[model samples]
Target: MIFYIAKRLGTGIVLALLVTLITFLLLASSFEDVARTILGPSATPETVTGIMQAKGWDRPVLVQYFDWLVHLLQGDLGVSVYTSLPVADSVVQRLGVTLSIIVPALILTAVIATALGVWAASRGGVADRIAQGVSLVGYLVPGLLLAIGLVVICAVQLKWLPATGFTPFSEDPAAWVRSITIPVIVLMIGGIANMAAQVRGRMIDELRRDYVRTLRTRGIPPRQIVLQHALRNAASPALTVMSLEFIQMFGAALIIENVFALPGYGSFAFNASLQGDIPVILGIAAFGVLLVVVVNLLTDLANGWLNPKARVR
Candidate 1:
């Protein structure tokens, strides 16, 4: 187990470094850069050169990337040209905001998807049809449109919650949770739907195995057999799906963040892309690639935990 974790952690670090190198290359190649954006038409040649030299933009792209990668290793993400703040500091502040919505949403997604999926898998007739139909509704809807619909129902019609923005959890934990609940729900809706489908498919397939038939012939109670045996075996795929979905959710949350006016890394990345804030944009992209690599490696590790057969040292 220690060896497996060490191997995965090593792979994740190497992948993250590669992602940073690739992002720097892409950012440098782009026509619009922070120096160009900040300098605008009000620049003399010296001023332009000064801005480039100051940001190390005047250096060869490879040299700039090497310097930037060294700083990243030392936990320096540079300064945001727009905010006049350390980019790492901005990301740190915003991470809490993003997790305030994501963490609870993930819990809710797990519970809802597991229950609905198990129930769907157990039911074979009209009941299964009903559960499947609801999953379809969420799966087919676009995240932005669904967020808009949720706002209409909860904010406009029910007047149950505020439409947007964040409340700091430290100052008012209860209200902070309250402020984020609906957005979290909206954020998770599609994820839960997709998870339900994956879980249901895996559970049903597990139930069809020869061991399940043998248990049935031995007159094992249906509930015990399904809950203890079936769910354990079936959940392996669901765990994999859940981990990957989280990686996707963070990237996909950009549209949902803009729709709901949430100040998250997703929203920050979206705006950075539009303004061509190369450093911030590349930082966010590097973070996203790191997220994907970590999640995928963790998912591979999870397989050993979920299935007794794959417990490599």
Candidate 2:
């Protein structure tokens, strides 16, 4: 198991490095001056050249990439051109906002989706049909549209929750929760559908296994057999889907963050792109690639843990 995990970690590191290098190359090849982005076309050539020199954009691409890579290794992720804030600090400050909503939203999604999946898999008739219908509704609803609808219904029309923006937990915990509650709900629209599909597919497949029949023949309670035996055995596949869903949600969070005006890494990335802030854009891209790699690594580790056969193979 340890060897398997080590191998996965090694592969994940190599893949992440490759991603970072490719992103660097793509941005470097653009050859646009950062000063033009910041100062407009009226800016003098000397001013543009000076800004590029200050940014070390005149250096060899490979040298610049190596310098950036070294800084990343040393925990200095560059500075934001627009904000003048260290990229690492910027990422840290906003991480809590995303995590607060994502963590609870993940739990909510898992519980609700799992319940629906288990109920549908066990009932296998009208109940299953109803569950499928609900899942379809969730799947069809685009996250941004759902967020907009919620903003109007809860914040504008009913005057219950705040439509957008966030409050720091340190300032007012209640307000913090209140602000993110709807945004999290919006995030769960696609999450619930994806998780339900995973759970139902895995559970239904597990039910047909020989051990499931044996457990029933031995007079085991139906609920116990389904929940304890079948669910546990089916967990690997469900987890696989859950991991993919998490990656999808993270990517979607960019749009959802902008809609809700939340100060998260996703929102930061979106704003940076609009401003054509190369350093910030690259930093955001690197962070995103890192996040996905970590998630994938964790998923690989979990797979090994859940199914020992995977470790040996």
Encode model 2's per-residue lDDT on 1-313: one tens digit a residue: 7788788888888887888888888888654555687768688888888888888888998899899989888988888888888988787777667777887787788889999898899888997898888899998887778888888999999999998899999999999989998988987878888788778888898998999999999999999999889988777777777777777777777887888889987887778777777777777767777777788888778878878887775
Give the TM-score (vs. native) of candidate 1.
Answer: 0.92
What is the lDDT for 126 in model 2? 94
Candidate 1 regions with alpha-carbon error over 4 angstroms? 31-33, 311-313
Least well predicted 10-residue stretch by lDDT in candidate 1: 28-37
- How does model 1 fare in lDDT? 0.80
The clash count of every prediction, one per candidate, is 0, 0
**Clashing pairs for predicted structure model 2, backbone only:** none
Candidate 1, 1-313: lDDT as tens digits: 8787788788888888887887777778663345666888786778777888777787788988888888887988787778777887777777667767877887788788988888988886775787798789888887777778878988889988878877888888877876787778777888888899898888899899999999999999999999999999988788878886787677666776777788888888888788887768767766677667877777778787888666563
lDDT (CA) per prediction: 0.80, 0.82
RMSD of each: 2.1, 1.6
